[model samples]
Target: MFPWGDSDSELIEVQGPRAAIAKPKSFHAHGVHFWEIGSDKRLAGAILHHCRSGIGKLRACTGGDQLALFKIGITHDYDSRFDLYRSHGWEKMLVLFYSSDLGQVEMLAPAKHVAAIAAAFAKTSSDGALSAIARCPQNDAERAMQKALCKFDLTLDAPVTYVNVGEQCLVPCLKPTDYVRTLNERGYLHRLIGCPIDSSAGALSEFWARLSKAEPQLEVCQDLADGLVDPRTLIPVYIHGDGGRTYKHDELMIFQFQPCMGHGTMHSRPVKPNSIGVSLKGHSFTTRFLFGVLQKAIYSNDPSTFERFLEHMALDLQSLYHVGVKHERTGVVFKFCVIGVKGDLPFLAKAGNMNRTFLHIRKRPFLPHSPEDPPSFFKLDVLHLYHLGVGRDFGASSLVYLMTLYEAESIPKAIEKLNSDFKSFLLSSKKVVHFKQITKDLLGYISSKAYPVGHWNKAMDTPVVVQFAEWLVEKFGGESTPDLLIRSGCKAIGVCMRTMLSSALWLDRSEAKIVGDAALHFAQCYGKLVHYFSRKVSACTIWCQNYIFGTISH
Candidate 1:
């Protein structure tokens, strides 16, 4: 609840642990005066705002990584200039600090916690003498602003010295082998530690130059490290160590090396019952990250939750990769759903059942607030797989499913009818429900006998994908204009109708009823797709489970 830093005027009273040691009231690198707080109440409000926006983590990435990298050896005097520390590192350090425009810091760690960090920073100070100042640009427009602003007789660039935050000589190894060696380098790999540097702290570029010098053998470090500390580095930094509080303004302690390719298997040897440690249910970093994401999604309604849900779903799927129930033929009938007809039935049943379960779990009254929808590409692929199963012969199954719903004793006649209907649907079919387009498409397929093959037309045969693209344009293209939405919707409907023609290619005389049943089932599954977007339920896991079970249970 106290203000941060020191100031001569009574107007800026900071009543916190580091209140005495904070830099004097002055403009931070971004040209904002942050040295004052009207009262403790204002600071409290700032804390609350931070919690809501999750800006603490967000800024940690910016100020912690970006800024730390920028001010490697830079030292501050007037709170804005850093010449003393800069002089120590052979002019390698440069510093700049920018207050976020998004909002105030939202993290309100306990005062004791914050105090610890402030206290640590305060201890690293030299004599209370102002060092030579450094000039900075006002904005991007004028490159000469820094030189002009130095009228206070500040230097543009000066000598700097690096702070040694502990270093270990690393005789790096090669790829997979080097990976293991790197882990041994930390001795206690489980409890390793490293210093954090903010890449955007205006000192990143300079700090990067110095860190590079520390590892001359890793010439790649000299080359690639520069890329790592560039102002544009947005990669998340997960450090490890004790004393997170002391690094509040600059550093943090987090997990060390993250295993990439064969990571799960690598840890398999270390933990007993490896499934518990590395599988979906365990205490692995991903699992922990997932839980955090879920907490945010459920409690804070963060949009990022959707992304996390899919990731968790993927892990669940990976866990099920080789699992199966033994049987002589196709074996055990795992309780899953049975929808659609023939080849289409299996996929539709699985997809529908999976989506339904997700919806059931998320039983809540809420309007659609997200901009994303379930992936249509996957759905179309499933549909394509169904088509391939019926057969490739354009004379029979293929034409009916690929073109329109008409009876053609011959292939040539069916092809002509399908082409005519396609042209018509593309031009007309406006203001129709998606299902209506499917019906029209089926009719056209029955009329045509020729089935489409090859990639180009095969792509067009996917009505749902085409409709999804059109729908996306309507919802997000430019400024969601009414006219554009209507036009986009019309095109979407047309594509759906044209694509429905594919169902005909799969129908035969005896299979007519089967096809009818399949159509009904396809409709039911398609309804699930629509419902998923409105409800925001994830279907991938459900799909995987049902695929394994053979019976899709919702």
Candidate 2:
């Protein structure tokens, strides 16, 4: 981050990441020393004036509770001008600052108050004497700084710039120190960061010692203890991308990081505060964060393009890691050790430097496909598979059977009667439905056509579906029912769907086990049921209908 030389060495050392235009520099709000480097003394093409390092104190202001602001007045041979400023005290960093004129400041309030106090002794009215005072007359020869209040200013700010990273990629990178300072000014950075401390071997050694005593089971707890004493604050950044719509329904790959304070807090907060985005347009998703924009896009066509950019970005971040940035709220120079990359499986696989292919590329049907791992390795969301999926099948078939058993002159009347009862049941249950109401089209059972399916919200409508069918069965069919096989088949299938929602977001373990057992049972039962019943039998026809109609919601 900082290049130090011998005491006799006057050569100003400058370094930058490979493919970077200028050497990395930090703007530490806290006191930080800067080496005055002339153009002839350092790397060619770098128009640098200063070199700030993780060294001694060079304060902007001596007082506490006062904001340190710097003047950006123009001067020819600025090198000589800044040298004079060194005698007074000012840190000029190589990093760019986003500055605008804040206007020429005047010390009128304090001066007026002092003058008013003096006027009191003279027996002249303090208020009248100050109130009557007008603007001072100005001449062209007067100092541009002015002896009176004027409209103009010279102040430094957080500078965002477009810099080259690779041959084809250029990204708008904010100085890491500036971003961190911005966070601290907002006064909520403590909640996001796990620990904040100054850099010292003693502090780091103390942290590792405390960490050694912590139980290995508490991952996040141990992580919190990283920056508590040590200055090297480890932050987890996640990169996730896919061709899908965002929560707002915009298409992009979103990157984010988790809050690391308190126990299990890291995992609890999954919202991404910072990111490089990927957009989905023209049937192709793009990793965009390159050149002249707040975000850079890494072309997804070549994964190595992204890999190279990261290498460059990492080199840039090393400055902040070692030199540190000042926190506005805490008034402490915090050296961050941002590491631990975590994200979705696909992103991790693509981003990681490994020989293994966790995901296979697929295009049109003509495109060749192969698996790095077996089909069994891949998992599906059990909630979608069961809760909103196969479970609906059982509901649809049971509804169809119940209506058929209603014994009206025709199937239409039977469906209408069952629909009335179902509405009453929903009212009694006081359940909210996503869809307005269950319609004949949703059921696939109108006068013109004859099919039945369950269509409703995944979770809320499930209980109603099950209870309605069971109620109708007990009310009319009972023990004398002929479509007993149909209802039995639906429940059997549901037993297989014993999949939890959040608990089993994926059928990685428990749900998979349930699914396996249920499938095996279904296969064995189907073999006997199909063999026992003739092809022409209505029992087999009804069972097939349940499987087809009920499993898929309309």
Candidate 3:
């Protein structure tokens, strides 16, 4: 008797409630909705032939396709494999090994392919010939001998009869249905052992050792079964750090993922994209907080700390949005209360009064100041940046072009008024400047094109519009800096403009059209300002060091 074979003669009680519902309709290849280069019917037939007879000559046989089928069946349960093979167009199927015995090849093939495999085995005159011969049984003793032969391939002189074995036994193979059901409920499949023995002969307890070793080797052909979408990539925006100047940055600075449906299509939407969006929102909040902290640090005489903060903020932004190319050429900058872009646009909008008040902190504003203010350039303020175009066409949102701000005493009260003003502008009044321009442009354009205005209702509900009110408050209410800070602010205006323009040009393609030309022009002019601040900062660092340490010898 096999050392670990369970007794086949023992009376075993089978107990379980019947399935509550009929078996679900099995998914087949014909059921799949797919359009591809080849015919699955022909492919399925070819696969069936190959499994039974071996791959002799198939015109388009790729090893990758062959491997895919094998891995699909062995790793995935039957139902999943069927769906996968049907969808992926696998033209060949074969087995590698069984969980019960790793050394031997297990069942392989199309349902009809087994007949050819059996015929092939009948012709082979190796030791495997006995395994084939045992398939045919003439009488009870021959059947018993065949059953005994299945236990060990070795031949013995004594005829192994069912009567001598003391009992007839049936070892049913665990069906794929059971395996899949277990996996669905438990999140994994249990190792099943199939071994036959005379039940009258012994207890099943003796087989525990062999049963323990029945675990199938699990190799994930595709690690991401739900099609490669991880929730982390969609919504990552937070940057956390100690209160010091240490900035944690991400090396993989871009958010890129292959949606199952493919890119640029709705079906290719990443699984859990909404969750990712939320996660990225949290990250944005964190980055905004840190950017504020770093700017404050700069005022505290720790400007170098802003560099670290910029690194964190840059990574946080990249995690959610496709802004890697922007950050690459344009070095991201962080300040005490607001982070600014060193490129054509400030990827981060300033929170609170940083743009309004911190005009003299650096040699230039982080964005191009309008031409109105002055000896240097226009003083960077929310009014000038948004209303007159801050970063240029590419860096600035079309919506920002619609806003203008005036000084307010208490920010929260101001925000309430701002909200009321926006509501009035949209619903009650037609006096807002930007809306007037938009309405005129839109009406004229629509009259010419003959498109109805109702189509734009969805755009009215766009997140940009819906969130604009709260966004404004968040931007200004977080920290309050007095306009006097603007007086002490150095000319960071130059550096801000330069960074934006350079980044804009670097990311633009050579064949860019008229819009591209405008963007490039913006980048070129703004980028030049960065150079001015670099020289001034270099000189100031030296002067501050010399004045404080009393040693310029180094």
lDDT for each residue of candidate 1 in 1-554, tens digit (9 for 90 to 100): 11223343222322222334234353322221232222333343243333323323333545654453332221223233424434554222111122232232333323333333434554555422111111211122122333333544332221221212113211111121122223334231221111122212222233233334543333223334455213222111111111122222532222122211111223133322211121222335422221111122131333333333332333222222122112223332111010111113333333233443222224221111111432221122333333322111111222233332346776566557655554455555452222333332443333322222222223234443344334433433434332243334335334343333323222235545544554444434333432333233243435433432335421
Candidate 3's displacement at residue 315, Å, is 14
Q: Which candidate is the best by lDDT?
A: 2
lDDT of 3 by residue, 1-554 (tens): 00111232111111111212222232231232111112222323343443332222221233333432233233433335545675786542322111333222232223233334545576664545444443432222233444555656433222111111112321122222222233224322111111111120121222211222331111110211233222111111122222222223211111111111101112122323111111111123221222222223232354333333343333333332332111112232111111222211121222212333323333232222232432222113322232223322111121221132435565344444555655654564232333322232322223222211211222223222323423443444423222112111111222333233333211234423433454344344333322333354454434333422325311
lDDT of 1 at 41: 33
Q: What TM-score should be assigned to candidate 3? A: 0.16
Candidate achieving higher TM-score, 1 or 2? 2
CA RMSD, predictions in order = 28.3, 25.7, 31.5
Q: Give the least accurate 10-residue stretch of model 2, judged by summed lDDT.
A: 276-285
Backbone-clash count (model 1): 62
lDDT of each: 0.29, 0.40, 0.27
Error of 3 at 474 (Å): 32
Model 3: CA > 4 A from native: 1-283, 286-292, 295-424, 428-514, 517-554
RMSD of 1: 28.3
lDDT, model 1, position 8:
31
| Ranking according to TM-score, highest score first | 2, 1, 3
Report how far residue 82 has shifted in candidate 3, in Å: 79
Top candidate on TM-score is 2
